[model samples]
Target: MFGTDTDARNAQQPDKPIICEVIDPTGTPLNVRATPNGEEIVTTLSNGRQVIPYKVSYDEKNRHWILIGDSLHSWGWVYGSYVSCLSA
Candidate 1:
């Protein structure tokens, strides 16, 4: 599982629902991985798709990754750089 300090910080915060939109500049569907920066793609999200961020982790290169889904189901992880989140 994710064990980054950023992930720890997010775990300490209250479970506030934050909505984020996929904004892949290439206009192609964004790959949702099973782990941060992982090659295993669990799914794909198109631009404008709204998702709820459940957790966050940063990779060694400092790329941000978010765990996204609804309240009951977790879709997977996506590169945070391609997502635009609004304040909750």
Candidate 2:
């Protein structure tokens, strides 16, 4: 019953935002790239940092990359494997 209220509210709102948290296993900050698997490092996210995922992409090696930010702006691309997402 703890999350029942929140779940019901989310169920009623199909357009509710999805929240993601950084979960890098290496215990280091996760890099946010300018592009999927690109050389440019736009920023970094620490473990447990929350972000909103907007889109997803795959690299040549099939590595999953997620575009994260808010509705009005995008932060950058982060490795999908290093993040855990939940609907909020």
Candidate 3:
């Protein structure tokens, strides 16, 4: 209702570096995975913690995955469902 189809898709893709906060519905630390799936968890992030994503990725079913950190840095993948974009 707000943006066009392309705009909506583009909004999901971060153009500038920004931070999103962790928001686990389970009231605990959220799992940061090596990939989008639940199989390989690389780290755990507490609620309200901020993460900087290099870009957004999608799973086979089109679920959003945030590429936390960078490929050459301390990076991991986290499902976008557990994160809330604060700005940008």
Q: Give the range where candidate 3 is weakest over 10 consecutive residues by summed lDDT.
A: 1-10
* Residue-by-residue lDDT tens digits, candidate 3, 1-88: 1123342245355454456778888987888888776588888989888776665667888777776663357568877777765445
Clashing residue pairs found in predicted model 3: none
Q: Between prediction 2 and prediction 3, which has the larger TM-score?
A: 2
Tens-digit per-residue lDDT, 1-88, candidate 1: 1244454345325665457788998879999999999989998988998888888787899877888887688888888778877647
RMSD, every candidate, angstroms: 4.8, 7.1, 4.2
**TM-score for all models, in order of appearance:** 0.80, 0.77, 0.73
Model 2: which residue pairs collide?
A: none
Overall lDDT per candidate, in order of appearance = 0.77, 0.75, 0.67
What stretches of model 2 exceed 4 Å from their correct place? 1-16
Instruction: Name model 3 segments beyond 4 Å from true.
Output: 1-15, 70-74
Decide which is better by TM-score, 1 or 3: 1
Tens-place lDDT per residue, model 2, 1-88, is 1133343234234486678888999998999999988899988989988887777777888666778876679989887778877766
Q: Enumerate clash totals for all models, in the order shown.
A: 0, 0, 0
List where candidate 1 sits over 4 angstroms from the true fold. Answer: 1-12
Give the winner by TM-score.
1
